[model samples]
Target: MHIRRRRAVGRHDASDYGLRGAEDGAGADHPDLADRRHQADHPPGVAQVAPWLKAYFTPAEHHSPEMKEALRLSDELVAKLIANDHVVIATPIYNYHLPAVLRAWIDHIVRKGLTLGFDGKGLLHGKTSTVLMASGGIYTDGSPIRDRDIATQYLRLILKVMGINDVTIIAAGGAKGVDLSRVTREAFLERLDSEIELAGA
Candidate 1:
């Protein structure tokens, strides 16, 4: 449910989201490499599924489509996750909640009878997930207009729907007003370093 200030790419493009291909084709198939197969033999930590992270700081290769097309392509993230790796999402909160792109990605990944299906016991289960969010304001508890980080709550529900109940959040706020002339960007980078270390542990 955390919102990262940075945008995420769903193995489609590095940046820029625009849903252009709505009526183009619906059943066209992606490559076999694009398919997410559960490989139990692989060790944990050897695999992971953070679409944006894979392309972090890299040059944008292409632009994502708009609307439903963008959501459809975001399924690549789920494909990467099928290998049974812990997930860490970096995103931003917009309009007091997660960005539409993030929601779009959620729609792509949370599949029925795939990510979550009733077992013989009628229970559900899936992978683990986490989120890192950045915001412009300092309201950790949020305001009347804002739902006090409703993004995090919604993310939990997303994971819950997929039977992935293990989730964590790290929030960064008021980053825009920082005194870059004084402490500089190193300080912020250090915080990210520590966060990555802790998450890796």
Candidate 2:
């Protein structure tokens, strides 16, 4: 099986938290580590499928050139997702939530004709997904700000709307300080490691 890696940030994001594109960098130190580590340990069992990465994140709007392009991009992304057996989203949290770029990207791909039907029934099925989120602050189940995590929650709910019920979320945060950074990164890796094993099983 192949694991698709979905990155939600861009180059300019580097200035902030050094950008999570770097697996070991400060910004989301373990960004997408789940997919990367899983693919490494699992050999060819997993591969990152992302044709829409080139589409990147586009501006949010329903009736504009960007939206039109987003629709096309989303259509392709949906196709890829439909074709894949497994998928994983590697993302970093921004302001107690996922970056706006990811939201915009989702807006394009979760199309009615593609992932859902006119009767509001989900058409996309027969696939499982996991979400790995790296954040600057802790937001676990009992965290004081758990309710503020719009990104992860939205991801779970939205993916459900697409008929993907076997969804799992691995949220790793509390990287705000030098002390918390290493600890947080380790925890993130550990969680991903466990999840990878489970997926392999």
Candidate 3:
């Protein structure tokens, strides 16, 4: 009914996306941590399933395999998106934008004729999504870099263009500087744990 704003963006490493493994494997057996349990819980009698897929970039020259695979993946990815009730995007922000690999993936799945309009309007409204990210510097409430974080804002805009607006974001910032990494990492991890706990609700 009203406008919604997003949280700050952070710098990230290529390895941070391993969180998706946890998302995909959420229903699997794991230790009894509250968050883990929360993650694994599902509606009564409803089965849980995790289907994994990958996308890669093809240069302007269109490397044969990469381009072919990306095109194919795009169709499947967009279809999966259309069918999904919830979507989770686990990524690291790169130089204030999306990671190159993730960006390419977005480009592939967000097709003009299929997922969204050519004028950047979205068709998939009413779906919900969550994004988990880590940054090299603190861009959250405690820091001064809040205004500089643009990655989440960009992502939210893109999703809106595709008509997906019910979104949530978890950003772990301040993981870069030598003197602040530990504090920032702790803060972000704590939030991550909290999110997992809330997953069951």
Candidate 4:
């Protein structure tokens, strides 16, 4: 099984965060936008068979319990997601890891008895979750800063509990190469487009 990673690029606006692609034409190459366009063209998973897709948008009203409930209602979230075509998480990386807001959301969703529970067989399982993470710096497996990949490990463990063995990761940021240019971003977009197609297939 494979895990598909979906990134959240537009989660941050230019005026707020000092990301490179805040301007109008700047983020065209962003992995999130690229996946959006690709999904628009080719929807992933079995839409007809699955049913509804409840996309939980985060980074809004961090103090609200309504937002935190997304995780608490593990059964509800799983039912909504499993019945839907595919799962997509659009999240940007902050400080080399998942943003605090995202982390909070995760805390709510990963309930022990709800999202995941172990059988007498000592196996863990449940719903499928995917993540797409983007950061200003690159951590593509072996860079010095790559040690900051605790987010990936954490996500993987969460999914594992829910019985989701399929996992995919797409990393895009300054770590891949030294020069962060439009060309590089475009290249990343192209790769993202291809991955979307593969996921759809």
Candidate with maximal lDDT:
2
Question: Which runs of model 3 end up more than 4 angstroms from their true locations?
Answer: 1-70, 118-120, 177-188
Off by over 4 Å in 4: 1-78, 118-129, 175-185
lDDT of 1 at 70: 35
Write down the worst ten-residue block by lDDT for model 1. Answer: 13-22
Task: Give the Cα-based TM-score of candidate 2 against the true structure.
Answer: 0.61
What TM-scores do the predictions have? 0.53, 0.61, 0.61, 0.52
State residue 199's C-alpha deviation in candidate 3, in Å. Answer: 4.9
| Global Cα lDDT for candidate 1 | 0.46
Clash count of each predicted structure: 13, 3, 9, 17
- Please write out the lDDT profile of model 3 over residues 1-201, one tens digit for every residue: 000112111111223523334434442342221121131321121011111122232233544664554355455656767766555565666676776555655655566656787676787877776666666766666567788788888888877878888877777554453234444434545556766455424
* Tens-digit lDDT track of model 2 for 78-195: 6656666455666777776666555654655566656777578777677677666767777788888878888777888877887778877765565454244554534545545665
**Local distance difference test scores for all models:** 0.46, 0.54, 0.52, 0.45
lDDT at position 49, candidate 3: 12
Ranking by lDDT: 2, 3, 1, 4
